[model samples]
Target: MNVSRCDLLRWQFDFTWSLFDYHLERLQPADFLWEPAALCWTVRPDATGTWVPDWAETELDPVPVPTIGWLSWHIGW
Candidate 1:
């Protein structure tokens, strides 16, 4: 199945979140708790042990943005 751009992004975020949840809990949740406006999700009883990342508002991520130039190959003629 083809996933859209937003779905792709959601998958990425959810995947990372799931990994973190593994360390905190032994069992998986029953379903995916999606927060549409926040663009994130939460599993039932997943990672409630520690202070989780706030999905309510966009936090200042330390992640570096990709470097792109105007003449990059991505720019099609």
Candidate 2:
């Protein structure tokens, strides 16, 4: 069966929204802001009044770890 382009898009959107909604529903307030690492990026402001990743100030030798808070904003946006 050949599915129309619009049907495919709607299916994709529904699937994605279902998965996103499932995760969001399961996420707790504390878990949403949990930082698993010492240098995980979050929504907290820094000394410069900027909400930057905790690893933002660190050298770029290693990639910065993103926290749940960061991921939520990043994914939503």
Candidate 3:
């Protein structure tokens, strides 16, 4: 059986999306903003009421862990 390159790529994408969906389905609304550590990155509503993720112009020595909301925003961004 021969699989085209497109077919392989499609399968991989589907598999990855399924894995993401599996975990996403289990997440509660609160989980998106839950901070697992004291020094963590998350999204905050700005003065304009738009949600913004924590960011830095330069990398920090200790990387801040991202909240699920931040990660999701990053993935989509």
Candidate 4:
């Protein structure tokens, strides 16, 4: 597989991934949030104030950090 990733400034691409603006770059972990869709919906802020899992508030949590790494790798690491 041949892939390449780029880290663009947030100001230039705010939530572009969610909108499918471009697939050439991977958004940083702090660039977005993660809204939980369980029995009761909740909003938790990620590194960049994007709603993510509440547990992500800790450094050793299994939420944003891991998910972001996975997304980054999938986007070409």
Q: Is candidate 2 or candidate 3 better by lDDT?
A: 3
lDDT tens string, model 1, 1-77?
Answer: 88899999988878866764564355333222324333333322336564233333555455322212111111211
TM-scores for the candidates: 0.29, 0.56, 0.72, 0.19
- Deviation (Å) of 66 in candidate 4: 11
Write down the worst ten-residue block by lDDT for model 4: 33-42
lDDT of each: 0.40, 0.73, 0.89, 0.41
Comparison by lDDT, 2 against 4, better one: 2
Q: Which candidate order results from sorting by TM-score in descending order?
A: 3, 2, 1, 4
What lDDT does candidate 4 reach at residue 76?
38
Q: Is candidate 2 or candidate 4 better by TM-score?
A: 2
Candidate 1: where are CA atoms >4 Å away? 25-77
Model 3 — TM-score against the truth? 0.72
lDDT of 2 by residue, 19-72 (tens): 877898888879867878775667777788976544354566556677777876
lDDT of 1: 0.40
Tens-digit lDDT track of model 3 for 1-77: 89999999989978877777788889998999999998899999999999999999999769999999998777657
Top candidate on lDDT is 3
Off by over 4 Å in 4: 1-7, 10-12, 15-41, 44-56, 64-77
